[model samples]
Target: MTSDRMTPEVLWSMGRIGTFNVSPDGNTAVYTVTYYSVEQNKSHSVIYVLNLNSKAQTLLTTSPKSEYSPVFIKNGQKIAYLTAESGTSQLWEMNVDGTDKRQISFEKDDISEFLFSPDEKLLILIKEVETDASIAKNDSDLPKASGMVINNLMYKHWDTYVKSIPHPFVARFNGDRIEDSTDILEGEPYECPMMPFGGIEQLSWSPDSKSIAYTCRKKTGKAYAISTDSDIFLYDIATKSVKNLCKQADWTEQPCDTTMSLEHQAVNHQQKDNNVGYDQNPAFSPDGQRIAWLSMERDGYESDRTRLCVYEFATGNKTYVTEKFESGVDQFLWMPNSKNLCFSGVWHGKTQIYTTNLKGDVKPLTDEVADFSLVSLAPNGKDIFCKKHSMKQADEVYLLKGNKLEQITFENKHIYDRLTMGNVEERWVATTDGKKELCWVIYPPHFDATKKYPALLFCEGGPQSPVSQFWSYRWNFQIMAANDYIIIAPNRRGLPGFGMEWLEQISGDYSGQCMQDYLSAIDDLKKEPYVDEEHLGAVGASFGGYSVYWLAGNHDKRFKAFIAHDGIYNTQQQYVETEEMWFPNWDLKSAPWIKNAEGQMQKAFRESPHLYVDKWDTPILCIHGQRDFRIEYTQAESAFSAARLRGIPAQLLLFPDENHWVLKPQNGILWQRTFFRWLDRWLKPDNK
Candidate 1:
């Protein structure tokens, strides 16, 4: 806490702000902030209710256990949230003043998430349901058996095996408690909210509260693994019937369906089009006339552009509202008038707010160089409330009134005021393909031009994710600068924010122009006298990790050190080892065993980092988590093995109790420490 510069402990000490919900009358807002306890190796979340008018924030929960996902209920008189105070997760309600806390749902199962209907008569509860029958625990003779029978391809997902999946259940709220709950998915072996990342956002209620719209991919096992084909379903409460809203044009070719009715029900016409990819997060209009959700065009491509699609309830016509935006919409809010929708999207290295009408006419609301997430609108509907953050700062609530963005909740202001953050500058570097790509440059706190400093080339992950003004707990640019290393993050090929052409360029050509762009950005910066060209390093996670591995062999001694976390060392092994088959099938263009006439697959597999280990001479550090199914730990293990076998200086950091991301407080600290220790050993030789 006494450090003037950013450090691992300092970064972990800062409170992280999460999702918030505005009260009914828009007078109060309840949000959650999570704090990590490194000593305890855990974290806790606390909820707070803020008066939007007075800007007075009050802590609503004082329990030792974490309380989060707060929403205003009973006409803003009570705040409802989920907590584990009773050793099991359940719904708890309290007054706006944080008194009279009482448990509502006493179900035997834990409620992962919950959403109340607009009329407050019905409640949607999300809980895990064990559908797989092959588990050893279910056998009468195998009471102590811990093995799982896997007969299908999606047996394991992001971190855990496919034993239980989340399903949405509809229950009646009779004021005091939830009752008469029934699983909307009944006996289906599918995930309603999906897996890994989906939550309550995938479920919504209509204005009348008689129907529930939920997102579900009704496929199981291999079919689920190789497709991104999720659909929106409308479930009627009275008849207990479900209808597929985003049905395929060819019903016979449909991978899955949730229709429970035998006869054709005269309702809103089904969206029978070739709209295949991911169609989820259905949001109903205030007037109950339309529903909007983010949609992707391709079926297997996960990084496809997420267009905002609206379905008119009256006409049964679906319209792509923000097709011309050229990028994906991250989050959106329906205007009070219901004629327009405001959304947040990345464009030119910034995630800004934009307003679009039903006619596809878009207007920029805020063009600042920081990332903004759409929260809600004011009572008057003209002003917008959003969470804004940048590379130099964490998340803080902001009110966008007309054109001005005023900071409302300074959740991390105390930490920010005490720390000296590095300055983040935006630069445009010319790429090897003759394109000007956006790159972010971070300088040390109180930077001096007379001093030469080591530098790091930050390769972005997601492969398609933008190198925007994002604030992160790990891979933080400001923290790297605080360590006395200038950081260059380039929005290279395959990253969004630059049109589809640039974003799609790195799909099959992983070791192509994108790697050159990383070199381009760092090469352009090394020309500066203040930058120590002799002490350059490259680092990344996921696909960015893949970039570092590829660059280790192709960097031509331009980099002194390399660090790859959960990256692919062998493309052939990754093609079958990854849980999501669609990712590899689409990005790598084909299975490794198949003969791709275009030679794309051959090129992709041939360029695997394990194959080029002979050229690796720089000191490299490899890290991975055993639970990470997306990119298995074997990838990192093989990379480290090959590096050492080639007589290169190498180190391996493995985390057994972690997933694709190092989530635990203590594990995260270890990651940062090992990260710096490796970099300092090679890149910071002068300082050592």
Candidate 2:
């Protein structure tokens, strides 16, 4: 029976709330509500509109359609989004009142992601294709016209084994029906050496709708699972003419090694050529007088310190808006007046929103509000929407500086206050072997000084990811804590938010010193009150999955259980077979991507938990998504097979159709339900 003492609401809420969009007046915002039901073993998200002025809400469409990426078109009167109907996500639009909804495109393609131009005249949706032929590894043919494969050397540098989603074209919508779905880009092999079509991206449109800027990913070799180089291009719909913008700037961002991620892009070119500049996140001033884009590479490397440049169309002069070393601004938006740039930045471990003038002089808008950053600027420009999340609470959209974070909605408000943080405090910990490494730790929740409870260490995805954090009482650590488990989640090396230096710490060394750091967090937490060293457990997914394999095998007695989800067991295989074939490709450049290579063997073994499998005796639960493009299914299969051979009592759970991150509501509930069942069996909560 479900325990009355259980506060699973926190877990349900964590699975629910996420950023959707802001209203026109900025006084209101929209977000999604995701909930996981243990009984049904499912998780679902429904769109919600928040009134910051009154802390009220209105639910939008609610069904298994998985309506997502809700963007405001003309305030909230219309929302352009992608939803599932016939098993494939397609572009759809609906009015504010939730009426007049219709599917926008009939293209026989799976709509993965999309964005609406500010003017609302155009909508760009990312499309993926399926075929009878096995997905290929080499670049030979460009996906031209229809049904052709997209080729260009630019794909060579990316995570090899990308999904076969090619030949993305931009379609102009007249009302809901598309008027033009044209191939605005093509390969100019003579100079660019690329077939222009591969990954469909959100093409940036000028505020005046005169021009669109995009990057044609090109450049290959030395890495996979990531792009090597891409050059931005300009398209003028009126003249039907296209030009390569980077051809004049010729920027080259070299691969040193670091983990800074927003989206898993096909390619991001670093500006190296003095004449050529590389930029991302193009924005035209509201008046459409000037264009502003990021100069992504600073001093031969992708610096957190990037440059913001504005080009005056009338004079053709480029102005470096910010004289300071800066760029890669998050949630950036231009003021309606077009005079100031509003963006969020990380300063001393805090993510805060700041405003900068056209010249780039900056000042913080929200202060001492940890992890508070601008979410959206209302279409009408009357209010600004932001989310404030702290160590103690799951993130919530708040009305800034007006009435103390007008808690936009009431959904999960109580969970934060109801949560028992215990003596578990947050601390930044670092360890080193070759370079300075950074990690974050949350001491056991409700940690008592006298009693000893089982300790669980979580090894999260290392690249382009932060160890999962939720302000709710339902985070894994918190949930485990509710069961008298002392939990420790480490940021570990090669994590984002930290500078490039820290993120690149694990470059050629995936599991070496950093693995020890995770173990160390366990050892350190073990010494604390209410922690049991003998009952230690570890869990992770993706790269963390590799860590689980590494840990389970090397020191079988160290953990009671190791939950490895979609982990990488065979490095050599992943580099070749995984659909998002970038992981294995990139790590090989740091060292030989071989099984028993001498110089790198020690470090490789440390990173690869599967290498120590012969000695593994710990009980482990392995989970995987059947359709995962990132880590691939073989990762789970090999590890589970190895465990069975070794008689380690390893359990396996596979979800068909689920990707790297389970998106379906039911799957999400099933994941947590199954996860907790395994936990209860292995690390049974004392609370029960």
Candidate 3:
């Protein structure tokens, strides 16, 4: 019999739920459930329609191919979705009750994402078009030549080499067929939806359906790689003209006074509302009089505060709504009344829903300890639906009607029922810097204070990502606890949900106070008699991975084992190898050779993990994906090699086909098994 505790196999067996769309009448919702098959080593998504009133659900599609992005169309009488039954993804429509299914689009290229206009007479579809001539044209000339002639800076991004770019096409739909399609970007080399994670979220149609607001950086090559200055563009469908909605007053037409230093020139440029940083995910109000989007103030700081900015189309006036929120907005939706908007922002240690009006008054709507994200509002606008998840449970749809929240979906109820979850307790410990830090302590299932349990220090990546009540498949706190180990995840000096000062402290100070914050959390927890202080371990990926490597040399015999995944081993090597130059330049404060005002480079490179391998005494497991261009796999290999050379008992788990994340099912399982196997060896000596 399988253990009643949650395991890697049980974790993978559970179904995952995605975001959903509500019908126009708000009485029903359509969502997708994704299930992974270990035997097939793949995952498939199936769409389902649920009556919001009666809590009745009906599976809509059963085709072998996955059907997703279901939306109610034709006045809630029909449902439209995308499927790949014809070998290439295309638009398909069906009756609301799951009947009269038929293909509606026959475009040559695959339709990655689509959105119908408010009137349902127009449609916008996202398709990958070959824009880079040198990459695609030359490839056809030499079909077998594997060599790529690189001439641009953004030639490669994330995991794949840049070739085809996704563009939005506006076409007229006459119920059965789409006609007179026009590429909004036309022949421009820029991507409308952006790359990697962006999709339909980057584009929003006006209520009048006469114009489309899209997010695009409009830069290529080196310019694109060094900046995060994407702007929101308003494209008029009838006039075939585009205008930059976030453009400042004559900043582009007026040349900057270049006599000053580059630093001084940037400061001068900041005087205007140039919207220098990322301005994306435009959402037009239901009335079509105003448009709002998530905007970041800094040019290269991707982790900058994402303020909600609203722009009035008539007056061309912009208001920074939610300025009082302090923290950043994750997602927002305009209320049906158009006077108020609901948004989700992080505060303390949880993401909660808040409402803000045009006058900038913010009010908390829900204050649950768990994170709540805005999904869709009811037709009445008073009732809202959100996706809520905690450290112990995965995502599930919840309906918020005033003070009452009802669970609308139970995608993994079966798995959850059979297993017992550990207790997640939030504790605030005093940091070495004379500040209080929040750390979540998760005990093993049926934990007893009489017995000693091994503990793990969970360092977070993004260096700026939140250590909130997040439910992640890879870094799940519950799974670690299920293995009879205590987990201490800290919202260190660099993590969000604390405040801006805390979040920005990690930048240019990777091995500084944030490191102390991690130590403080573990040190405080290890003092507990129930914790096995001698067998502590540190594990993280990306920036967190960098933390593990740094801690290994400087942990002072505090930890017995270390696991670093796709972490930065050498600061000098990472500066040149990484695709995005802005990330390292901002975080490290300068290039490897150049010295900043504070001489951060000297201190940053001086403390690189590769430099302090002499102090490593603990066993380590380094896992990395070869395709992780953000932080190359070579970082992990170098760490692993240095450990083995020092005879510190190291293991390297490399995936050539994977990226920064172990996405494949089989690889994920292997990762979990190897992770526990290594931990059990050093941390649980008795088990070995």
TM-scores for the candidates? 0.96, 0.75, 0.97
lDDT of 3 at 670: 95
lDDT of each: 0.87, 0.59, 0.87
lDDT of 1 by residue, 571-630 (tens): 899988998887887788777766656654456886887778878889999999999999
Q: Write the per-residue lDDT of candidate 3 for residues 1-688, one digit (tens) a residue.
A: 1387988788888888875999988888999999899889999999999988899999989998999999999889999999997789989999988899999888888999998998989989999988673354564667888777777787788998888889999988998877777788878999878887898989999999899999998888866776788999998988988899988657563333221112223622566677778899999999989999999887777898999999998999989998888899999999987879999988888999999999999999998879988888877878888999999889999989887899999888888888889999989999997999988899999899999999999999997998889998888899899888999999998777666888888877888999999999999999999999999999999999999999999999999999998899888899888987778767876677775678555567778888889999999999999999899888999999999999999999999999989878899899999999999999999887
- Kindly report which residue stretches of model 1 are placed more than 4 angstroms away from their true locations once superposed: 133-138, 248-250, 254-272, 597-601
Candidate 2 similarity to native, TM-score? 0.75
The deviation in Å at residue 533 for candidate 2 is 2.1
Instruction: Report the lDDT of model 3 for residue 685.
Output: 90
Worst 10 residues of 1 by lDDT: 258-267
92-165, model 2: which lDDT tens digit per residue? 77876567778877766676666566666776655544321323333446545234243422222122333343
Model 3 lDDT at residue 539: 96
Clashing pairs in 3: none
